[model samples]
Target: MKVVNENLPEEKPRHLLGIGEPEDIVEGVRLGCDTFDCVAPTRIGRTGTIYIHRNGKLEKTSLRKPEYQRDFSRLDEGCDCAVCEKYTKAYVCHLVRSGEILGGHLCSIHNLYTIVNFTNKLRDEILHS
Candidate 1:
């Protein structure tokens, strides 16, 4: 990707497909890619997994985990997404454990918001630098 990025003209935007992981997004940006699209975010969301930013790092979190069963905190602190605004970790965990479809919906909402916000931040940082 680095080599291809170097060879491409600056006017040509690089768009990476099926590369949606946090690390991959950052790396792709570093390699001069301008855009990305992938199903990994929604794919994981379907399984009750979501993404969160912590200590300046991005990580995956599963609502079905034991710890979340009693965790009454928001899915992601400081997130304004609808799911995070109204749902508790315990509630989401319970929903998933109980085999409810809402569990995945909430996770998807939070995960997609995280990913979009992450990429936007990355772009701002790159532009300012």
Candidate 2:
């Protein structure tokens, strides 16, 4: 990404293909990428994996894990997404363990929101800098 950013004209928008991980997205923006596309968020969400921010770092949590079976906390702490606002880890874990479609949908919503929100913040920071 650094090489690409160095070679490209600064004024031209750079679209990064298949880059969707939270940390990667941050680095991509820092390197001047203007946009990104990938199915990772929804794909992993389908399997009950979610992106979460903790202690200033991005982490992946699998709702299907046994530890979440009794965890009643929000999906991701500090997230304002509807799923995070309305659901608990235990509930989502039950849905995923039961193979309910709503589990995937809720996870996808939270995952997408996480990435989009993070990207927007990065954009704001760059704009203000």
Candidate 3:
């Protein structure tokens, strides 16, 4: 991590790489990381992947299955992001099923939003802490 941070521009915001889990993001923020990116969400989404949150526990959906063909729901109901607001699970699932480029893009957008937004929130938390 030190080596990677050393290579970044001193004037630029410091970000931690390969962050995935929500808790990991929080830790990175505590460590002064201002940015983070991960491929898990999209990589998994392209395969009919879904994410479920229940009792504060995260459940990842696996793509390589036929069940998502008709399941319709927001990827994360708690998420008010564009993808969750304007899209449906069934549609995204279909896009993935049909090998549509939009599917991955949409998923990537959401995933990016989730990470970036979470990081921002973490920053806010740190400022107040």
Best of the candidates, TM-score:
1
Q: Please write out the lDDT profile of model 1 over residues 45-126, one tens digit for every residue.
A: 9889988778878888888899999999998886889999999999999998898998988898888888999899998998
> Which candidate would rank higher by TM-score, 1 or 2?
1
Q: State the lDDT at 99 in candidate 3.
A: 88
Residues 1-129, candidate 3: write the lDDT tens digits. 566656777788976667777777666655556777777767765555655555665556553356766767786776778888998777887787788978877776776566566557667877798
RMSD of 2: 1.3
Better of 2 and 3 by lDDT: 2
Pairwise lDDT winner, candidates 1 and 2:
2
Cα lDDT, all candidates: 0.89, 0.92, 0.69
By lDDT: ranked, best first: 2, 1, 3
Greater TM-score among 2 and 3 belongs to 2
Model 2 lDDT-worst window of ten = 23-32
What are the TM-scores, per candidate, against the unseen true structure?
Answer: 0.95, 0.92, 0.68
lDDT for model 2 comes to 0.92
In terms of lDDT, the poorest run of 10 residues in model 1 is 52-61
lDDT of 1 at 115: 92
Off by over 4 Å in 3: 1-13, 37-54, 57-59
lDDT of 3 at 9: 79
